[model samples]
Target: MTDGDEQVSGPAGGSGAQPADPPVTGLAAPNGGASPRRRGPLWTALALVLALLACGVPGVLLLGLVGDAAGRSAVGRKDDPATAAARRLGVRMTAQLDRQASALLGGDRTGFLAVAESAARPDLTRRYAALRALRVTVWRPVADGAPAAVDGRPGEWRLAVTVDYCFVAPDCTPSTVEIGTRWRLVGEEPRLVAVEESQAKPAGTRPWEVSDLAVAVGERTLVATTPALRAKLPRLLAQAEAAAKVADRYAVSGTPPDRYLVFYAGQAEWQRWYGGGRPKWTAGYAVGVGGGHHDVVLNAQSVSPSGMGELLRHELAHAASLPAEGYSDRSNWWLVEGLAEYAGADGQPVNRHEGLAEVRKLVRGGWDGRFDSLAPADDATDDRVGGAYGVGYLAVRHLVDRYGEQRVLDFFRAVVHEHRSLDDAADQVFGDPWPALHDECVDYLRAIAG
Candidate 1:
């Protein structure tokens, strides 16, 4: 299935994790982190994260960056002209970004234009003017990169530096974006010349370009859609709030995210924003982005009225549970997906009984792939992918039945937050090895489906 922002891959043959929603590269660059370790007590890290959030660090300390180019005060050793120049250029670029961020956040088109190149300022101004809410932080400023000679200019050089930013809005999360800009020698000091966004625009399409979006902000959701779908906002908001509440219940031990950002558009708009990799059947997806927010994108054209809540909840489950850094181990794809389904399974796309029946049919048809071996539904048939969802849901359901809800939640924390191997985490909760846990899950599915 095609990837959505949160990728609402269908029940089968689609992204099971949304598989994080189909790998559609968007405005934000992917957050980087080490994979969950196979060994070590991961709960130690979980404890620290929880402790930080408990200290009300969610609003202020949302991100911890490694470098700040804009704020660099270091002066290299004497006689180092290149370092001095880089530092000088870095300061100018930082100021430009600060102005850009301030203008975007304040909805001050004129202010934003002051820092932008005249050519792009009009478009930027229009986009910012239409934007409802925006927050920008330059986590890593443009710095330290060396300058290269421009293609045609003899004396002039260009330094291309990537600025890492966290952009949050009413209908967007604190999604990480890497904006590249070239600083060129205009007169004396290096000045901003060209800027490049990571995501390429699909021809003739952008959310801001969609002229008549009706936007509304709920207590825990931000809904934006065309006038045709505007009436559906109230119900969507209610369901999102309910889903957030449910997700919070499971995530009380960790950081409960802030208000979710839901962008409702048709398939075309969805594809454009998602940078085009979504499967045809994908309804929508909610991306668990960094900086304590999630990005929910839904294709209103594809989702049936009854299925919207379930799909949103399914994505919300991912938003609530998955770490901001993203899930690393593909081997636990089933659990990753199953936990989402189990959490959001108020029953619409498919209820427990229906899903079980479907799994039973698949087992009868000789399906043999273990949950651990199931990868994202990149190439598999839809039926094969859907079976993964069913089996995953049942697996999580069995765990919940056996260990209770909190333990199941803790298991996720150990695996995702703590970065422990699935086996190691299962060992902590079940007190036995992972093989035994797998067998029990299989047995549970059989008993329920037999």
Candidate 2:
């Protein structure tokens, strides 16, 4: 929602209501003679007007003074010299940003670096190269607000900037992020001094911004990795493309993304980038970056080559099927994770068996036959969490088996995306009440576990 319309206020006098003329103090006599009371007030008014004219103040100036006193204006006030200067600075800085964006898109390194100060050129150059390597189709930097002058620094200012960019072509839905930038005006030109995270509006760093990337592009996937994993880029891309194809089969809600953007994070990066709150056992995650676009991040050092395919499939399924607004509640965690697990374990019987192993162990422990009981705690062990995922998968699988895959997907969309009650969605999609469906799913899970 960057570059939205600015809100504007109405003109000088609020409600555009004019002030009433001063009340007539007295009436003229019927003999065509003014009363003494009226003559006295009229002379007083005339004397005040004459006094203002004697001071060399024009009638318009008199009116303006009156308006000022009344907290209104006959005409709008002009911007002060300082305010006007800052506005001009913002305009110049915006033009400079436009040039920088154009330079990055056109692959003109020299032109891109030209807008930055000498001290900033090196970092700017690195950013330019990273973005160019990513092959972003859209790069627009817009001023989020007016520039503010830096205290004690002449001709220097700071501004909040929002950048919108996209990776895929033909359906380039841009993702927007905010940045804080500093600039110094040298004569009529503005040079960028620094770019940093906006304290006012922080956003997750893009993969290119995290480190130098070894990028491999495929027809339906783009895999980016650190130089440390450059040797593994091709294998990762092949797996990701394959996973994307599998993920596309579940796109009953809409078309799959044009290209699945994947970032393979090394050990150091896994701890630093993409908001960094994932559990240690978590393999990968998908982030909805706006406009139905998503980006996948993988723990490259943690997952094995054999396990990577399933992990990719799970996250990619999320990318393909997750609604723009995301799921409504954690109560639907089963459907959320289950759908991904079902997609990941598709056509892999051994994987399915391994996934349900923990569920079987829990059933032997006399656990309650409720999916709610399978919801993992925040600090749950990896095995327990895996069991929960397995239970979710079974729930989804049961629905698919009884009703069919498309119906299951539709029911999922109704509950998660449409924010409908599970019972309501079940009644609509399956012609059964929620309790009946819930009991059926629980029975199926226990039977599968046995």
Candidate 3:
């Protein structure tokens, strides 16, 4: 990941590595579609993940609009009939929820008994309503067993009485929708477990049409272009698997079936997609994500012998881990880069990209430093790309080996739970300051690099 100004406009140049590399502009986007579709949902489901990603970041959902959820007036409304319907369902669900919630909170035995008894009767919520007219389904009493008696203890409780609202907006288009719900009793009153409601158009997988070597991952779905590139998919999967085995700190689902989502971007859209007209970096990336979906996209031109899977791996790693750059985390730069690079390989050293060696050599001091652990990554404010991976990777490697795999996981978890300062963690765990520890790492790398 080169800096913004490091654009290679002319001929591609590089160290004589096996697979050449692209002049990368730190940021890129997956090439999926806003294509028209039929059936289930393509963009809609994608929107959920995207929305979640956008959460706590700037400008998601609202796009440019404004409103507040969990407030009286909701902002960022996508008020299409489907969304409105979902909102309506949310409202009714909240009402039924409120009743049980009241019973639970007030500890009103009489009120609770009335609601609980009604809850037990067959189809009680909409007992009198017609299935066709109400369009409601009640699958109450879900515990992987029979219904339970509702009491404060040792009793079965059901809270899910689902309702689907379908009223066409002034547009007069008959909008169809559905929502399913199931609730379980925590003590006596039922609590919501599943509430799914959305509008969707089953869409096609979006891959950059021009590229023959992009990667994407989902449920049993790994799509790329050519057989040569496809061959690399297993390696990505393998790397994910091995890394997951080493520690449970990097992915969501244990890497068993990567919740990873891979997308391919065609050559045409590459210029416009990410990095703006030139190239740029993006926020909201997972530098050390444990799981969920990740996208690996590539351009057609990237398959040339000059191209390294670095960008694919970088972005994918960011998808898996995180890709915070600039002011976000001046301290953790080295760490995020090294972990991604380590995870980027196809498992076999023979298949590893040679450019990586260039990086490794640089860290080792080209026969200079004593080879302890590279150098401390300069604060992110410096904008120097070299130190981030050099220092951080060595530190991570040392920590992983020194503490045992489990402790390394514990360290990462500590970061998540006690995410304050590296120096603090060092002080707390190793009884040292971060800067002092980093110097030791540099000396260590220098020693090893020799």
Candidate 4:
């Protein structure tokens, strides 16, 4: 998927770990809760991950990352030389990760005591650091070449682990995790070569101060992370749920277990975890990893008239519809994004005054395909941050007036289907490829503004 160019992609701390055995907890970037081993510990690390999953904690990031099969082989045979040698090294790394993750998740306090007390030993003062939780999940493991770098010199390998973590509210937010660690040989056992904490506003340098963020509403997770932002989440989510409920009862039905609302401090923090930045919508987008099941990650930090509800409507639309289509420029860019903008804002357009002002802005800029078609809104500083969201935002407003809602949905359905381009799907929607109606859409938006 394309990076949301206008925004930011903070440094990804530790990324991509073993064949996922979802671990319990971990944190990073914002908080130094997890410093995944940058050195040796292949077999033992992954085995512990597998053990955690087998032990029944759903600790894994759902993004598909594979673990090393060769490493696992050592575990099955007790006498395997590779397994015997790496045990201490592996145990050290796993214990470290386990300590951090457990603390981060606010796991059983007694359990934390038991492990720490049992594991302490002589000579290693590094083992006595105060504990903090790191919410982590393994994607694919990488064998560090620290061992091979000096040509047989003493070395360590790393289990390149991808751990996705967020400030979790006990039961208010839907929890998901995929635990895995990457084992790449380094100079010794897992050692800290790098420790990156996302200090930006998007991800934050520390946990959000949202004590009242979580409130269970008829089985739905809702949170208000801080006093200032806290008041807004309820209204926003309430509106969204109201919309979804309408769809559920009258339009669609039944929400999935994974569906959740995560309230953060601001736009940038949300971006750190899930922002793809702003891509030229026309070229299409890539959602999480190789792009499947996930869509634009949403947070309440980004708001205005273009704030929360409308913002979510737009983003969530991309998510809901992506399953029906693949995010590629080869597909109908117009149908995918335009259709999403259309669907999301359907019953939820910005207030008429704000909406009209937005139309005025788009009309003045003139809908150049260059801006709206391929450039990301974040980069459109000349138009402020509105970018083409305003342009396409209004176009959606117009389509609902012209073709009826089902037709708009039909366009999305076609665009969503694999191997089909927006142009291919055009005939089904407007009875023309995008360029054919491009000018017409521009004119229609301008006329509405006038």
TM-score of each: 0.72, 0.79, 0.39, 0.53
Ranking of candidates on lDDT, top first: 2, 1, 4, 3
Predicted structure with the largest lDDT when compared to the true one: 2
**lDDT per residue (tens digit) for residues 318-391 in model 3:** 44343211113323444544454444432324223333343455654343433223222212212223333434
lDDT of 2 by residue, 1-450 (tens): 011110000011000000011111111111111112233443344345445545666541211111112123213776433333444455567767877888888889999999889998877877877787788777767665556645466546678777777774734666666678898756456689988743221125666665788788898898988888899998888998899899998775778877788888888887766555455455676665555556777776667777777778877887787775454355666787778777877666533445667777766766676764555554556666666777788888888888998889899889867889988999999998989888888888888887
Q: What's the lDDT for candidate 3?
A: 0.34
Instruction: Mark the 10 consecutive residues where model 4 has the least summed lDDT.
Output: 10-19
lDDT of 4 by residue, 1-450 (tens): 132211111010000000111122332221112223444444455455445545666633212212233244445565332333444444455444555455434544444343232223221112122112212222111222111111132242333343443222332222223222323333443443322232221222222221222232323323334444655655666755643432232121123323333334444444344332332221112132211222233334334434444444444444344441134342234344454454445555345423455446655755454323432332343332233444555565566677776666666556444445556766767786666565666777667667
List the lowest-lDDT window of 10 residues for candidate 2.
8-17
Clashes of each: 16, 0, 45, 76
Give the better candidate number (2 or 3) by TM-score.
Answer: 2
lDDT of 4 at 359: 44
lDDT of each: 0.57, 0.65, 0.34, 0.37
Residue-pair clashes, model 1: 16
Among residues 3 or more apart in sequence or in different chains, the pairs in candidate 2 whose N, CA or C atoms overlap within 3 Å are none
Q: Rank the candidates by TM-score, best first.
A: 2, 1, 4, 3
Candidate 1 residue lDDT tens string, 1-450: 323223344642223553342222223332222222322233343334345545656442212121243223343534233333333444454556555656666666677667655665555555555453323333333433434434455433344444343434334333443345555444443455555444521111335433346666666666677667779878877877777776666552376666666778765577666464666546666554445445677777776776666677777777677665565566666777788777767533334433565577666777663777754455665566666677888888888878988888888888866779878988887787888888888887767667
Model 2 lDDT, full chain set: 0.65
